[model samples]
Target: MNIHLIAVPYDSAVRGWRMGAGPEALLRSGLEDHLRARGHHVATEIVEAPDDGPATEIRTAFVLAAALRDRVRTAREAGALAVVLAGNCGSALGTVAALAEDEPLVVWMDAHGDLNTPETSRSGFLDGMALAILTGHCWAPMAASLLPRPVAEDHVLLVGARDLDAGEQALLADSAIRLVHADAARAECRGCWTPHAR
Candidate 1:
């Protein structure tokens, strides 16, 4: 298998802080070497925020997402699996944009339900609205900038979500997106997996 690794080393709109360092940390931990040892061809690209960039978190997210979308598209054109190592969930928008042809099913595994919209969010955290953007719940202009295709709510499966705000909880209950609680996830996984007969 050929894998194209896209590294996003920024958290929210801020550069070089917090989760922003995760991608480089993973790379330093011999990720490339480990993948090569597993007999896969690997290529890497780093997506960085411009030195003079957007002033707001939302704008910054869109800028980075656009870059990631282009890179993902290029990777797909070259017949490589695009794997994004991102600092935040907002980057998922770019991944979805690149791959959402004929409405691809999205399996999102996150600690929080990242389904808050501008109207429902209390913390004012832009990253919290990433899933909403992907589902066309808000940020229509920014979402359309990358790609107009929005993953249908029914096609979204959110796993391992344990930290959700009241708004997020209410929204989840009303929406078609499937939720697999963190506690029950392991049991569900075990039930789904079966050993093949030799």
Candidate 2:
């Protein structure tokens, strides 16, 4: 299988993961070699932020968004079958928007539903509002980058989700996402000694 790895490296404003170290840790945890050993061609790229990139909160979103916009576009055009945009959901969402040109089938695998809009977001973190933007529920500026259209709410499925934020629950009720809570999705999979809970 062909894989394009787009790294996000943002950790919300949680005070632990915004440092861009997340990608390094994944590499250290054997992401590249393990995939190559399995006969997958894994192409790699990073969301390049300045060493002195803006440290302010909201501006950080645009800085990160600009970086991700370029990275995902460059990687998407490199000609891969599947692109893995992994890491902080904030940057990941921007990458997905950039890649919406591919007419993607987005499988959002996460613990939280990630369906919060900026207006509804109690936390005000971009990470929490990623799914809402992708669904085209809000975020006119960000969604505008996804030429032709945004990922349809119907085509964007969710799995491995056990928890739901209050905002997410409301959105899910009104939205068309094919949300499979972790247990049900696992139980529905065919013929595996151990189901892929992740």
Candidate 3:
């Protein structure tokens, strides 16, 4: 299999800080070499926002998304699997946008639900609203333009979300996205759930 490793080395629009350092660190740790040893052909690219202005969390995030979307599209057209290593979960927006025509299922595994809207996000952290944007729960105009169509909630599975805010919890309860607790996932190894939908 041909694999494209697309790295976005920025966290909250800042490079080389906090989670932003992760992608480079993983590269330096020789992840590409390890994958090559497994016999899969690998290629790498780093997505970067233009240095035209000061970086703000939200604006630069979308800029990065657009850049990533193009790169992912190019990789897919070349029949390579695009593996995105991103500092923030919002990078999923770019990936999904590139594959929107395929109507892919989304499996989101995170300690906290990335389900907050502008109205409910106390921290104003754009990353917190990533999944919400995908589900059309917030940032409607921008998300719609990027995603082509809203992803069906039933096609999304939010797993290991133990740190949900009240608003996120309420939204999850109302959404069709499957919520799988980390504990429940462990039990699944012992046949806690059948493959059939519940």
TM-score of each: 0.90, 0.74, 0.92
Clash pairs, model 3 backbone: none
TM-score for predicted model 2 compared with the true structure? 0.74
Question: Which has the greatest TM-score?
Answer: 3
Instruction: List model 2 lDDT by residue over 89-177, tens digit each.
Output: 76655666676767778898889877878767887767677777777777767556543566788888899888788778888988889
Distance (Å) between predicted and true CA of 130, model 2? 0.7
lDDT tens digits by residue: candidate 3, 1-198: 999999999889998678989998898999899999999999999988899989988888888998999999999999999999888888999989998899989999999899999999999999999999998999888887688888899999988888999999999989899999988867775665668945
Mark the regions of model 3 whose C-alpha exceeds 4 Å error after superposition. 190-198
Candidate 1 stretches with Cα past 4 Å from truth are 190-198
The window of 10 residues in a row where model 1 has the poorest summed lDDT is 189-198
Q: Give the higher-lDDT candidate: 1 or 2.
A: 1
Instruction: Give the distance in Å from residue 187's predicted Cα in candidate 1 to where it truly belongs.
Output: 2.1
Error of 2 at 190 (Å): 7.4
Query: Cα lDDT of model 1 overall?
Result: 0.89
How far off is residue 178 in model 2, in Å?
2.0
Error of 2 at 197 (Å): 14
Clashing pairs in 1: none
Sorted on lDDT, best first, the list reads 3, 1, 2
lDDT of 1 by residue, 1-198 (tens): 999999998896877679988998999999999999999999999997777844578888898899998999999999999999999889998888888775789999999999999999998888899998898888987788887667899999999999999889988889999999998897778757668833
